[model samples]
Target: MNLDRSIDDYLAHVRTERGYSEHTVAAYRSDLVDLAGFASGRGVEGVAGIDLALLRDWLWTATERGLARTTIARRAASARGWTAWLHRRGLIAADPGLRLKAPRAQRTLPRVVAERALADALAALADRAAGDDPVAVRDAAIAELLYASALRVSELVGLDLADVDRRRRTVRVTGKGSKERVVPYGAPAARALDRYLEVARPAILAGVAEHGKNAGGAAAPTAVFLGVRGGRLGVRSVHRQIAAMLSSIPGAGPSGPHALRHSAATHLLDGGADLRAVQEFLGHASLGTTQIYTHVSAERLKQSYRTAHPRA
Candidate 1:
């Protein structure tokens, strides 16, 4: 088969069979395209002529060009995937990418909001938005639920009218792999959600007035969190709003939706939640991914012990 054909088919397999997301597949496609072009320049005609040396040369060239370690690693993974597929399909005798070493990347721990500070920030948000206005009510609910549930910004915004169970204090979240999980929210978030459903949603949705006045008085269907134009909440909108609101709040370091998620997991661990439970709560497929927070908690505990223990 041709070089392009081999690359395209391999990417398709990664996406469909490997269950990779579109963003991941797009990155893979781009990286492999670069590898293909570079291999061509090195007089490597196709999969038949590709070798480990060519892969190493491409990675070396990439590093020399000052690509970030993360990008270099991703590109290497893309090349490795392509080679493995080619070998598996009998298009090549061996996988050239098998022995490739990815550049080491510094793994930064996820940022988390401090317990006291996160409360103060939420309190401040409530204080400032406490007018009986609908927008105020909605903003209050948004902040409360974001922390209480640790929803990904996407899952938070994608919520529907029926998705929340106020009584149960949980929401049905459809996560990656279309895996559905019911995540619990705190009582404070429940109160805010109740208020929003009772009062704020109607104002945002603008039921009867906006849709040309239905004969039966029905309105245009709306998403749970309406944008200014009364549409579904988008990721950027949530980021911008959360950033603006939380920027001045102390201890909400480098804040975003993920900060709340990290905080939720860390706090859970602090309160003696199991690693497996946190993993399922965060929707992480691998337990190892959820294990990072243990390190975060360990740091906190060590600092506390040093400061509090009287080493007389």
Candidate 2:
């Protein structure tokens, strides 16, 4: 019945039973901790003390403290989920959050690098990788596959050697909610991946052997991408690499691997790819989630027309 105990139990349920990702579970933990602290200050320390008014006031206090609308909305959702769980478990007499509401977060369009700019940037990377420096070769492959397949950084890092089909130019990726999809890569990405596998990957494996770190026994490490230490690459490393690359390019919004994803999706739409097909390609569960690219495309068209039309 303790609020803290209930929150921990709910988080464990979501993580173990519901299969929510670590990142999602962490966010829920953060929100619930903050709410628990707020509730304690108001003499409400038990699950039974949680009421709709307390929930609304907590959100109002968050807004008063100038938290972003997205943060406030997410906090509301977290609290609502927690309260609902308690009610379902018979800890609370009734769910107080059934009518809970928070301000909607403003939806902003994702940053889309111009096709020419992205092509030029990749060309520079390819040239650097031509010398077959292991890191450069691996980087080129990473960037190419990211943009080509519009893959999430996690999906890119999660790839195992057997998941890729070089002949088919496709990679099997596991996306959100543990959904698996086979996505195709362009010729450029295929070439880059081949170079990495043939030239660079061997060098890395040799380095790993030198360090006596081939702990996977007689079989090679299954990870398609590896760190300098010969272990599977991490997501933060990919984010750092892509952010550094995108930082040099002029743009607003995010400067990370996701920009490549946004660019690929927008470019596909601009090139007249079908909306639903693009949705499936991106492994989006909702058509509405995929529709954001259409907005980006329309915004680009308006900007182009404004620049070209003399009547404006």
Candidate 3:
């Protein structure tokens, strides 16, 4: 059968015989539709005539358009799954996408705030709080813990009544890929957190009412940060606040919550922390992923070299 005919038959089979949900069927349909467009652009008319080279060419075309590495990887997986289904059903007799490799994009070095500038931003938060805003107090604690432990904003907000150990100065964090790691902070972060828990959390929750999102509680049970509505703090609010604060500081390139995580990693490496130890602390799945921070160090070296080398 031709590509379009085979896809129509596969959709029906998956929905009725395989008991696939409508959403799953829809996703499959969309992926196949895009694949068909890609194949047409390659001058291949049907599934039976498709080859692995055509699949590679399609992905190369996407790379030329600057599709992110993760996006290209997902598209490649989608194509492989479709071709495998076609082969199993005898529509194409083989899977052409099996050998098509997604192009690997280089990992860019993460942008980080300079140590002095990051410290200054935290100091500025105290003035933001002295104006008698509980939300400002909460914001200080939120930003402090985020940078202190390199915590993803979600992990920071997801805490319950039992995640933090004040005595140990540590937090139990659930990281990406469902992995758990404990991260430590220092006295400064601890003091910021203590102030929030004692003074700010109650005030923010007091004006709020019960809702599905009020999972944290009226008294900020265990969340290191709480939304104005007594719910878990969300990524957007934290991001906006951080951006506004960081952009005011020199040496922090534009701003985002992620800058805190990057700054923390880079500073640790600069302070003579072992790369392998930093890898585990950052909870990187691969050491290669953690190695990008070395580039930041190299950039700093180049700056110092240009200034100090005596050769014009």
Across 44-111, the per-residue lDDT of candidate 3 in tens digits comes to: 67788778888887778878989889778777876887788888877777788778788665566778
lDDT tens string, model 2, 61-125?
A: 99999999999999999988998889889999999999899999999999999998888889988
TM-score for each of the candidates: 0.84, 0.94, 0.74
Put down candidate 1 lDDT per residue, 5-64, tens digits, no spaces.
Answer: 888898788878887766678888899889889988877766798888888989999999
Compared with the true structure, all predictions reach lDDT values of 0.81, 0.91, 0.80
Model 1 misplaced regions, further than 4 Å:
2-5, 40-49, 132-136, 207-222, 250-253, 310-312
Worst 10 residues of 3 by lDDT: 210-219
Worst 10 residues of 1 by lDDT: 212-221
Error of 2 at 7 (Å): 1.8
- The candidate maximizing lDDT is 2
Model 3: how far residue 38 lies from native, Å: 6.9
2 or 3: which has the higher TM-score?
A: 2
TM-score of 2: 0.94
Cα deviation of 103 in candidate 3 (Å)? 3.6
Measured with C-alpha atoms, the lDDT of residue 153 in candidate 3 is 70
